[model samples]
Target: MKKRWIVLDGSNIMHWKGNGADLATVREVTRRLGEMGYVPCVVFDANAGYKLNNRYQDDAELAKRLGLPSARVLVVAKGTIADEIILSAARDQNARIVTNDRFRDWADQHPEVEEEGHLVRGGYRSGRLWLNLPDEAP
Candidate 1:
């Protein structure tokens, strides 16, 4: 697997600024990650559209917001948890997951959660997007 592959927790990142679900934050982050030479794979919960647009939106709609192809943007199936999907994608792709969540509950099953630089955490402190991606991996 290529080390440049990165998984983004779209469901969590959208709330980076605490202003509610904002796709702009996701878009900017995706753009920045791309600039840094990482291939972004964004995973969102099924209700992400409802939270952002007050209506149901498909993968294609959210993909447009992230400026990525529908294949790269995943809206998990209904009744499925997004965190699980995010972690699974990271594992499957041999990539790191970008999220503020510690995933303490899954630590027992996914020990990589405790590894350094495994769960890259970042958020906006003053309207500026920040990510803790390691220089080597990012």
Candidate 2:
């Protein structure tokens, strides 16, 4: 069977100005998912002059150094929206998406796309993040 794909909304998780806490959280989640053998794709939005002085360059570079597939970490150009791109990619690839946006409601409306909630518990002690998959009736 093909490995499950997890699409992450990089822009949503990073927040404006690239908050450190948010970035750390995202990195932790990504690392954990990799440990679990899940394919993760994180998409971030880039401005017109992003190539000149990009804030996420370090992130993209790190992902590259880690040998992450190019297709899995994308930086969408300006004028193109990240949310829409993420949704489209998920739908096209039949992959599960991870986002805190209500826009996920649209995916819930689709019969083919399964929507689930993620919970990350614990502060300093041993913690775990769980993916709450939709309950399936036998």
Candidate 3:
């Protein structure tokens, strides 16, 4: 069997508020995925009009520090939507997507792809990100 591929929506994970996620949280998630033997990729939006500094650079640096390949960090350029890029990547790579966005409805329309949504909360448990994996590829 082929290894499962996980594509993460970078913007959603970072929350895109200038500051990246807590290093521990990011490491924990990545470590968990690694232990599960999944190939992980993170995609972030990089439209020229986004008006955010260090968008791609920050993500790239983090990915590098985390030992992820540059190819795994997709920065969508201007005049396009990240969703389109994500969908295309999922279709082309036959990978599973992870995002908190409402793209579940759109993903459900596909018959050959898998998607997982993460619900995160910070509290006594130091926050948790729950992954909702689909019953089957769709």
Of the candidates shown, which would achieve the greatest lDDT relative to the real structure? Answer: 1
lDDT of model 1, residue 126: 67
TM-score of each: 0.93, 0.63, 0.63
Please list the residue runs of candidate 1 whose C-alpha ends up more than 4 Å from where it truly belongs after superposition: 1-3, 136-138
Whole-model alpha-carbon lDDT for candidate 2: 0.56
Ranking by lDDT, best first? Answer: 1, 2, 3
Cα lDDT listed for each candidate: 0.88, 0.56, 0.56
Cα deviation of 57, candidate 3, in Å = 1.3
Q: For candidate 3, write residues 22-107 as lDDT tens digits.
A: 43444455555667677777666664214234334545665675577776766676555787777677767777666556565555
TM-score of 3: 0.63
Best by TM-score: 1
Pairs that collide in candidate 2 are none
Cα RMSDs, all models: 2.1, 6.1, 5.8
Per-residue lDDT for 23-102 in model 1, tens only? 99889988988888899999999999999999988899899877899999999889998888888889988898889999
- Return the clash pairs for model 3, or none: 110-138
